[model samples]
Target: MDVVLASSPVDGDVGCWDLQTGAEQMRYRSCASAPHGLASVAGRFLASSQVGNSSSGSILYWSWHKPQVEIKSFPVEPIVSLVSDPDGSFLLGGGSSGNIYIWEIGSGKLLRKWQGHYLAVSCLLFLDNSLIASGSDDGCVRVWNLVSIFGERDNERMKDPFLFSFQEHALRITDIVSGFGSSNSILISSSEDRTCKVWSLSKGKQIRLITFPCIINAIALDPGEDVFYAGGRDGKIYLAALNATCPSNGKFDEYIITCLNEHSKAVTCLEITKDGLSLVSGSDDGTVRVWDIKSQRVIRVLKLRDGPVSNILLVQLPNSTSNLERVAKLPSLDKNLDPTGTLTAIRISPLNGPPDFGYCSSRLMLNAIKELKQRSSVGAMEMELDRLREEQRVCAQLLQRRKKLFDDLWRARIDTLLDDDQ
Candidate 1:
């Protein structure tokens, strides 16, 4: 099921709704989330970074059907952004102190930590399974290759740690979104400078600088990469041309193909549905609006009625996720980085490869266990256990006999040595 989630800084609940039916789901409560800090952890659970004034901030996790937080971890520094890879094996937290921390989600072990930006990290996006793009308050957007960062040896020297760094925006970054390509995808970043810059990952250069009428707080790319929707502080969502070229008229108004003017306040976040037919946006007006892409009209409006919506996410949850299943199989997030700890989580391959992650394999194992429980009886299981114990006893007896034989052979050799010496 495809669901859209909205979070607010002042609100205690994270609002969730069905994208297809526009029906409200279970509202995950007690979450005052930071902007760009809400994420669906590979459909297993929901996680959000809390808005806190303290030096240390916390990240909370809630089961899909639960309203209360099930797990919480305080990081070394306040994290402003949180994201997980599609495989759900690794969770990345961008700290307020410009450091990015990667944790193994299965074991909750901190795998790596490095300074990713000059200022507070604003947003983190996965370009592919192996590449991640981070935007910061320093107005710099950098792409990091996870293969080199995580897989490379400490003694080995990387030619350049960052794959690409685009420092075109003059103000703090508010949001970052990527287009359909893997490593060669086009990255779009919205900033407080009233501009949205598009960078080419393959080319490693700024391709387009779009000047908006207002500071674009959020951006959502069209599935085809033909155009991108930019939500401005002026309460308008501007559809800017991506493939089509407009004659370089110096006016910023020329870049806008059309605009959605229903939002009464600054649009805080934007997300396009999986089918690319609907555009969902959250705003300061405490409403989440879903717009039909073809008609460019609001089809559904979900009233949050709490505070300004800070983040929005659209994710596909598995149908098998039972509401009755309370405890999540995943581990809790670790409070601090453990250098001596080992990451027992099964590592995943690149996005293009076949499935080998723990979550995917775990589902299969769970299904097998359910099937076994249904087919086997208690008496049959006990009989099987007794048979296994008998086999173990036989092996133990054989080992003892072999040890006695070896000891006897050694004594015979020692006696022969004594006779030869006499």
Candidate 2:
């Protein structure tokens, strides 16, 4: 399978690398400023936006197959985030100005601009063909109706405002994601307040809140939709289950079971393949690691020459079905079935494609287990710290009340003494 890693250089250019061959596929120098947002459509085209420079902010669309000429340039504000529709017909760009612009991919025409947010729109996600959800720095998530925007063929303008606005986060929403699991639509948002919240999109109410130790940069959900992965600024990756129901007392337990601690820097982006067999993680350390989800180990580490990897994507090639079938028939090693010295299918072939690096290190597994224990201990300590902070706040409020009460009593006593003197 071919994987693509797109990185926004700290200096200037945007670098795209091929993961399989560890080669520099292409570099685009269109963004005079640093590119903060990147999105791909139809697995053959990409759109990138500059972080700042409102007047000069532009989105560059380029073809991945050719990688030579630019497809089109759409002028918009410095885009903080971008997301393409599932069908790749429409591309949505959101900027720090709290405005969302929709563009037609094939025609390169601006369809409509969504305006209503009072602050910057931090994140955007296309829920379905007729609906879109946006989270903003104003601490509210607004669900927009795409049907109303494009209903009139003569005038393709957004006539109606946001359908519903829900206030959940007390801080800016960093990322918003939606998943369909168990016949339910679950929307999750990570924020700068060190908390991740899950909302029911249909009901427009929050169901659960997952708090973390540090600021969450990004979140990824498994294809099975049973688990969610969150990357924090503390250089830690957390895995939490979504099957746990909310509690009656309006409190639920969100625990992190597994942590990937190989990277020394923050994990910027994460993506899971369509089959959900593998996961790819990009870090500020300028390295991308492909992980085996079942084995819980790193399969391959692709190091980049310059700049940290801002995003990592797993694109299935055209001939993936045949390749997958060939790989599946290689061998099977079932020791339990061959206990009586029976020959197994794996024994027939002494050599395979490449050595399984995931299983080669028992020491790494031991260290990971050890670190997991340490993190659990640290998490307990963090909880204790939170308890102490809450207590301190309560104590301060009590102290202020007591001081007021004492002053009142003292004033009353003084008034009595003045009356006696009179």
Candidate 3:
């Protein structure tokens, strides 16, 4: 079953509903989620970055079965945008101080952190598994390589981790979404400047500029990438053509095909279903509307007593057994970046080589993996062979242990037979 999640900045709970049946699910509690802060962590559980009442910012984790918060993490700085990688190996947070932090999922250890924008980051997106794109309140969109982010780098590279920076947006970027591709993906960003710009990642330049009738707060690209849906502050969802050719008449209607105008207030967020048959949008009027994309009509409406919806996530629900197991195994997010423990020296180089002391084991392993990527093919192959040999030796030792246990059992059976004969 597919689930649609919506949250408001003023509300304390994150509302969830079955996308197909329109039945309300367990509402995750105590989350004043910021815009672009709600996420499904590997589809295991729900996580949201809170706009707390206190000065400090916190992240809350919720189990699928329970409504209350299961875990909470307070970061050093208030994080406005949060996202997990495709694999859920790492959780990334864009801080209010313009810093971006990455934390290892299992260990809950902060791996690497750097300031990417001059102003606060408004949105964070993983273009793919390796590349992450961050849009800031300063009207800049920057892309960073995950491998290079964790690897050992010189001062120049460390100071600026972004591979490409696009500063064409005249105002703060409200939302960003990437189209389907690996290195050649297209990114569409909506800004407060009343426009949405399409950028090509491979070419590192803007490919199309689309002017909107109002300030667009959210953007969702069509599955075919032929068009995109932009939610505007004027309570309208405009359908803009992406690859469709149109005359450059310098008019807003030239690029816009149609619009859904049922929203009573400003549209806050928009998400298209995986099959591209339905478009789900949340609005400031505290209602979630489901639209049939083909018919361009409202099919379902969900009401929330809370304030305006700020975030929306569409995800598949897991089976009961798996959901229970996941909830039981979910780790508590650590508030501290560095856990209090004895320091362990780790080797980032070859096996049994000199230790690269003064770092956490998880981070050291990441650095080692990065080093392997930088090494020559032959050296990396040799290391792989050595690792396989070690695994083989361990398997042989386990076999011997099993054989010894069988031999002991046989001898005991023989003694019992001899005693019975006497």
Candidate 4:
């Protein structure tokens, strides 16, 4: 497995963790306080946002072999969000001044800088090398086309690289994540307004706006893009369907498929593994939980520091054949068994893990629903069987009519032959 890296700016520590043994190789420092500012550079090095207050912010790059920062670049403004390009050629930072700074990684040279929004930029991501998406405190999401901006030879030919803006959330943007459906496909943003909005880049409009009962702190999309997990401040993770119908008025109960309450404190951050099979979540309780997405259960939990769990990263170590073997050993959808054995209910998995044991677990609800539920299941099955028999009878009658028609056609052909002979 890749050494999962987690950071706590308050504790001034960056730790390398593995699931097999909970022993942590944490490297603590005094000058590091960047929240949600750590990103891996293609397994080569780690990049993080240094504590930036206003117009004075810095980004540091540390080699994988060393504990000290190998390179540093100080931008004019304080940086709140940091990301590296796919190829690790350049780095991008969203600043407090609502400006984006791009620098070459090899030689800390400023490549391109642009004023992105009207307020502080909260989150930033590269949709691709040519296009990047940014979210701001002004409650606007903007897309910039690097090709159009850097491609221009003259200022007259240079149109504004701003491609599209999605403005729907009524509060400060807390987190923005891309790479869901396709390249520049779907962008989901979380906010303090207790809503997560989905924007379709190809459609150039907002497709869905999901409202919750509490402020959604973090979000992660499933690999299939059919559903997403929203981690909330209420200490619950709600699973919502994307294709499922929501009320036209946007106030009714949207299709929340399920909720996972594995954490006791507020969920602060979330990240899905590369294969999207597992979800890593950090909480205010200072624990990093690994969740089995399919089984909707917690596989492992690592308590790192005493302070709040601020950020988490799941990486793939170089010798990761064991991870692949574990993935292959995972039981199929129908098997209700969580291979991790965290949810150890002794029962037959009737295709969907343990039979809604919740149905039988609660004394109050079980007493209330037992008789009605008993009658409903058996009655529904008998009704369905009767309907199937009626459908089969209709098929038999249709087949007889077709046979009669075929006999008539043969009789007509015989009469024509007799007339020719005469």
Candidate 5:
């Protein structure tokens, strides 16, 4: 039952296709759909965000094998992005007013609402069950620690409120994806600035910034985390290096090794499969294309009349054990996606210990030494402060005694002057 689901640009007509065969399954009439605003709600249903000229922003859920919306809810503001937890327990919506709204999937109840960005939230995704990665129009990609944001906070000062805020993109952020680098530390972000940047979480900085000939709207990572594909307005998909920290053998850091020439217009959304073998890309041309990653060529194309394909999803359901027989199966990947084409892939590599702050060992040691020295001097400084306070108290007492003595002496002088006058 694995299928590729997509929405049309006009009035939200949803269509499904068999992933393995590229055969069209069924078509559903969408009430409406936003750009990059579709997400598969587990394997049971699909969720999409829609904002039309006459209708308010709403989230609509569609059941499999049906063309009508199953459930729908309206939010206060126009929702631009949507995502749900892996278990389908909660769904999150990014609004135009810079707020993120979470709702319970079963009951459609509002779970919590918090401000996630300034101006507007352009993209969002669940890095895992615990972390939510968001990209904003403010030109930043931020990682929100779900545990800290929703868990206990009894005076723990939130250091760097966001798990991490990537400020590499100077212009409005078009898309951001993780799971490309290790430990969710690595991130890929595209912008209207015509650049796609690769970040290292273990390194905590921009490992490489690949500039494209046109503005990049969407990005997808290679399965091995070695290369990433960027879809730009120029109708070209470029492959950029990920692990190349510096230049290779004196040459410039391999920016774009190759390009996939396909769509004639801007590429809006991109999705790679769990096996990392194939990729699905949607464009403004109202077509969905599946390409073999190794071949770097389009193998099948599902042309649609939906103005343009706003968002795409490759849904892979977990296999259930059979009582009759047990067979070999492929491993599921740690993949990430957004409701919109502005994707944020989150693949958190197994962190052996604590989080890496991307600081050099030597610099960290120096800071540790300085911190120890400061810690050791704290007691001495506290004592010195106490001594200063005691000295000030003693001076105040001495001044009080002198004032009393002067007053008494003045009174005696006045009495002697009065006697002389009599």
Candidate 6:
């Protein structure tokens, strides 16, 4: 897999590195200001934000294959973070001025602007195709229904439709992540207040809040969405299960958490691949470590010669037919299943080799297989449920026709008997 690492130096130049070879591939010095946030779409294009004395920041897009060419550059003001839509059609950027702008990815055209936050928006997450959650520095998180905003406009423009907002922290929200389990729409946000809060999108309320020893630097969810791993400035990583209950409005319960103090420096970035076998973490210690999530141990540590690893991205290696083959071998759904029913079985393949029963095996291939199984089971169940619903509708129509025919025949016999009596 190709890994792209971007870092913004204090000198106002953006440095791009190829993680696989540990080589500095390209450097762009457009804005004379320091960059703060970096975001990428499809691994082909990246957007880096410049934040310094310049009141207006700019986003620089670079070609992933040939990092020398500048694909596009657009100007934005007080930009805090940038995020691309799931399909990469639009790029959403939040600014310190409490304005969010959506731009066409390819053209860099301003599509719409969302204004709702009372303070600077720090983090943004696309909950689904038509919903976005934005957390502000004002300690409030707002959920926006993008469908309602777009549906009301005739010109395909988006207006602000703040579905709900919650003030759970006394400080800025640093990170936000959307989970991928049966409770799909759950969102977790980490703040400078040394706490992580879980919010339910369906209910539009805070469900749980987890406190930490120090400021939480980064947070990541397991592929199963059942567990959460949070890294803190205290150089420790904490693992907590989502099923554990906590103090809602008042009551305290079992919110057990396991802490691992392996890193000597603050963990800056954490990413889990689509196949949940391995997790990679980048830290301020200038090292990137790949961890076996099942064993909760670091397997490989890739040391860097330059500055600290600020970010780490895992891209699927091109021409890797094995990954595709593993995905194709997933099981099909049964004919009888509810479309909305939760998935029961998840087959996890090994990461380095073939499928195995042992946990934390070095086989990447096996881990991929297991991850594929989980995804396929859920998808197949949904498909089967849809098919069954259509069949049920057809059968109901046939039964209704048969009942009508029987009623008509009985009525005809009664009329004939009455006529004979007369």
The top-ranked prediction according to TM-score is 1
Model 2 lDDT per residue over 86-191, tens place? 7665668776777777765533446566564778777777776556888888878877766545543433234546656778788877777788631136788888
* Full-model lDDT, candidate 1: 0.80
lDDT by residue for model 6 (118-170), tens: 78887777765556788888888877755445434432234436766778788
TM-score of 1: 0.79
lDDT at residue 380 of model 1 (Cα atoms):
50
* CA lDDT, every model vs. true structure: 0.80, 0.62, 0.79, 0.66, 0.68, 0.60
| CA RMSD of all predictions | 16.8, 24.8, 18.5, 24.5, 22.8, 17.8
TM agreement with the true structure for every prediction: 0.79, 0.66, 0.79, 0.69, 0.70, 0.65
Q: Model 2, 86: alpha-carbon shift in Å?
A: 2.1
- The digit string of per-residue lDDT tens for model 4 on 1-422 reads 55667776563667777754656654634335454678875554577877633446566665444566555656666778888877655667787877776654433445556677778887878876556888888888887766555544442233456767778888888787775433337888888888888886665567788888798888887878888888889899888888886444443346676678988899988888777788888888878888888888888888765467766766554442221222121111111112221211111113453222111112332344555456787755654564466569756855664554355446546655776799
Q: Which pairs of residues have clashing backbones in candidate 1?
A: none
Candidate 1 residue lDDT tens string, 3-53: 889999985789888988989988898888888899987777888988676
Ranking according to lDDT, highest score first: 1, 3, 5, 4, 2, 6
Counting clashing residue pairs in each candidate, in order, gives 0, 0, 0, 4, 11, 17
Between candidates 1 and 3, the lDDT winner: 1
Off by over 4 Å in 4: 19-23, 26-33, 52-55, 152-160, 180-184, 246-252, 319-422
Off by over 4 Å in 3: 153-157, 246-253, 323-331, 334-422
Comparing candidate 2 with candidate 6, which one achieves the higher TM-score?
2
* Model 2 RMSD, rounded to 1 decimal: 24.8
**What would the per-residue lDDT of candidate 3 be over residues 44-90, giving only the tens digit for each residue?**
67888887777788888887788988778888888899999886667
Strongest candidate by lDDT: 1
